[model samples]
Target: MADLVSELRQRASALGFDAFGIAAAEARPDLSEKLQAALAAGWHGDMDWMAETADRRASPVALWPEARSVIMIGVNYGPDSDPMAALARRSSGNISVYARNRDYHDIIKGRLKELAGLLSRRTGEAVKVFVDTAPVMEKPLAQAAGLGWQGKHTVLVSRQFGSWLFLGAIFTSAQLPASEPMAESCGSCRRCLDVCPTDAFPAPFQLDARRCLAYLNIEHKGPIPAEFRKAMGNRIYGCDDCLAVCPWNKFASETREAKLFAREDLREPPLSVLLALDDAGFRALFSGSPIKRIGHGRFLRNVLIAAGNSGDRALLEAVEARLEDEDALVRGAAVWAFAQLADGERVRRSAEAHAAGERDAEVRAEWAAVLPEVV
Candidate 1:
């Protein structure tokens, strides 16, 4: 069993995974309770899938009863430069480091399937592989498999890889030796908590997804709350403030995967350029990227919010162009962005011109909400 585990690690390394570990296919004793507590507290926000898949996510054995050993792997995606620097470029959209290139789901899933095939061939056992698309409780499983500990920010933090790892797992019937779990090493560190722009963390290791910029910009489906727009700064797709502040990142190495390198165009795309994208243009720009999953409407809504926070008067024309956009969500965000960029009288005049023609109640309300109170 020990020899098999050693060979598995070597194969994973050869396949380009930065870290690897193995664990028994049993439930972690505390996972079900922690998941229940998080869902009960409403910290998951509109992510109803967490509630729906709670039972399956609680245990690997529950997910695949015949599985006897689980293989957890990590692929490092550390950025070459500080991701926070893009936030300061107000006129540009700040895409998260992970999403600034090819979609990790595709990249990691393909590699995981390859690894699973290797395992099956060697052990003559059936195997299954999963990336982020499944409800596998990957963070905890990674920790249990000795990959890393879940940090105070609710993300896995590796002593070698920091918070930049993209995790995947393989479940098999082979009874491989389990690696020892890693102990939490984050002693007396509050940097991740203090660094959150939206105060997403309610306590150490507890996150309120509703208040997280990454959740709001990515998973959220409706108009962004007015309160969060300003705090969002220039972050359009996902935010990286919490992860960037971690001390363990000092030991992190930049991703060796060429496909995962940040695209120059996506690294700091001008708000003006992003706002000009029609559905076809949006699709063309993010063809194989993860940002494409949100579709053009949600992507535009995020861009408009960033435009509103940009405080760049130059974006007023771009904001105004979306006032009558086909999507109500985009129109609403445009209205809010226009109000921020234009003066009170100009906003009022534009509102009067568009309010009568506006069919969406929410978009009309945005016009009313941003206008100065009548004397």
Candidate 2:
């Protein structure tokens, strides 16, 4: 069995996984208390679903009691070049590293299943695989599996892989031996906290999702909050400010996962081009990626916020097109974008057009305020 475990690790490495570990499947006894503490403090914000599945998220054993082992693997996804420099060009939208090319879920999940099948064929055991979903605490499980210690950013970080790895796990009924845990190497570095544009982290190992640009752009369903809109700059989809600033990333290597590498079109894509996408256009552009899950309304809302922040006159036409969008959320965001770039006269006209017929009270109020002399 030990030799089998060793052989599996070799296969995973050949399959492009940077690190692999096996964890005995048992409920993480300490996790429930930590989850209760986080939920009690409201660190999860409006992510009410996290609270809904409280028991399962706290431990894998509670999710599937029959599971006896979890095989966790990490795939390095770092690009060869710097991902942060794209931010300096104000006219372009900064997509996060994870979403740069093909979605991680598809890439990692496919490989995890192949490994699961190999294990099942050898041991005649039932297995299920997951990446980024299911009721799994992948980071904590990865830590327990000895893949690596969870870093200050609360992500599983391996010294061999730095912080640029995508994770996946296969749960099996076979009684596999577990691996040893890795010690933390974060030491005294506070660079991740210092780099946050919205001050999203209250402390090391804690994240306030409300203030996280990733959450704001992707998870939160409503308007981009007035306070954070300006700070968002041109980050249309998600923010990588904290991840990009980690000193440990100096050891990061370019990924060999061709599917996970950044597409030239996604790197610093024009804000105008993204803003021009309506529902059909959005569906066409993000067909196979996680971005498709965000839907056009929420995505366009983020783009409009970026368009407002771009401070570039070139995107005014795209902003103008969204002014008449049927969705009040998009129209409200468009009104804000126009206010950022257009003169007072243009703001007045756009605001008035939406003010009378807009059924959404919040959007109407936003339009009223955007009007030049309405104050």
Candidate 3:
């Protein structure tokens, strides 16, 4: 059984998984208590889903007790292009590299299932595959499996793959040998913490998802906070400021997976063109990409914020045009963006137009607030 486990690791590596490990399929003794504390402190913010199923998420045993071992895997999805270059081009809306191609959930989940199927055939055991879709805490599970230690930024950091890797896991009833846990190597290194534009990391190994640009741009459903707007810069879809500035990523290679590489069109798409996308147009453009999940309203809301920060009067027309959007979320964000780009006269006309015609109370209030004195 031990030798067979060795073969599994080798096969996984050959199949392009950068790292592999197995862990005993049980909850950490302290995980539940720590999670309860984190939740009580309101660390999850607006993410009600995490709080809804607190029992199942805090413990692997509570999730599926029949599982005897968890096989963890990581695939490197390092981008071929420079993640930082797009920041200088204010006209281009910066899409995060992980979202540039086919969604990673689809990519890594398929690979994890294939590996699980192979293990089932060899060991004659039942196996279940998971890739961040389950209640399993993937980072902690990966850490237990010896894949990597969780770094200060709350992401799995590997000595080999660095922080530029996607994680997946497989659970099996077979008793596979578990690997020794990796020790934390980020001692005295504050590169990730120092690099954050919004200071999203409140403490080591803990993240305030509310302040995270990934959360604001992707997970967030409504208006972006006024404070973080200017700080957001040209990052329209998701922010990579923390991940790109990590010194450890100097070791990362260009991804071998063609789908993981940045699309030429998406790399630094013109903000004007992105602002032009209506719901149906947005759907067609981001069809296979992860950005599609955010829907047109939230996405265009982000683009409006970017246009406001652009300081380019050229994009003001597009920003003004969205004030009449059917979605109040879109209209309110447009109100905010126009306020940012608000001039002496443009603010007056917009406020007059919306104050008279705007039906949504929230949007009307936002329009009335756009007066130059208030703006």
Candidate 4:
């Protein structure tokens, strides 16, 4: 079993996985309680699937009765440039590092399958593979497998990779020797918590997704909540403050995977370019990237929120162009952004022109609310 684990780690490394470990499937019995506590607090926000899949997620055995051991693999996706510095360019959109390149799911899943096939061929054991798409709680499982411990921000932190790992897992019927779990190394560091623009962390190791900009910009589908708009700043896609501030990252090197590196155009896309994106343009720009999943309307909604926060009057024309957009979600966001850039006279004129003709109640409500405050 020890030899098998060693062989598997070598294969995983060759396949571009930076970390590897094996754990008995039943190692962590505390997952169910932790998951229930978060769900009861409604910290998950609109991600109802977390609640729906709670049972299967809490235990590997629950999801697969025959599972005896789990193999956890991680690929380091460290950025070469400073992500937080990009915030100063308010006229441009600050995309989170993870989404600037290819979707990790597409990259990690195939590698997981190849490694799983090896374990099956060697031991004649049944195997199942998963990336982030599965109900499997990869973080806790990764910790139990000794890939790394969960940091204060609840993201896995490796001594080798910091918070830049993309996790994958393989469940097998063979009972492999388990690796020793690493202890949490974070001592007095509060950098991650203090740096959050939205105060997403309720406590150490706890996150309220509703207040997280990453959740608001990515997972969220409807209009962004009014409270978080200003905090959103120029970050149109996701927020990296919590992860980028971690002291552990000092040990992490830039990723060897060229596919995971940020594309030049997406590194800090101009707000003007983003605001002008139509559905076809959005599709073409984000073609194989994870940003495409949100669809153009939600993408524009996020862009407008960032535009409102930018305070760049130069974006006023692009913002006005979306006032009569096909998607009510986009039109509503455009109205809010228009108020931020235009003076009272222009705000009043635009409101008068669009407010009466606005068919969507939400869009009309946006015009009505901004009128008294600005006009």
- Between candidates 2 and 3, the TM-score winner: 2
Instruction: Please give, for residues 116-189, the per-residue lDDT of candidate 1 as tens digits.
Output: 99888888999999998778999998999999999999999999989999999999998888889999999999
What is candidate 4's TM-score against the reference? 0.97
TM-score winner, 3 or 4: 4
Put down candidate 2 lDDT per residue, 1-375, tens digits, no spaces.
998898899888777788899888873578889888888888888989889988988877788887899999988887666777878888888888888778889878878888889899989999989897877888888888887777777776777666777889999999999988677878998787888889888889888888888998899989988889998888888887777777777766545552256888887888878887778989988878779998999998988988888889988988988888998889889888988999888877766666777788768767776763553
Supply candidate 2's per-residue lDDT for 284. 87
lDDT against the true structure, per candidate, is 0.90, 0.83, 0.82, 0.90
lDDT for 247 in candidate 4 is 90
TM-score of 1: 0.97
Error of 3 at 27 (Å): 6.3
- TM-score of every model? 0.97, 0.95, 0.95, 0.97
Candidate 3 segments exceeding 4 Å error: 254-259, 372-375
* lDDT (10s digit) by residue, model 3, range 13-58: 7677888999888836677887887788777878898888889988
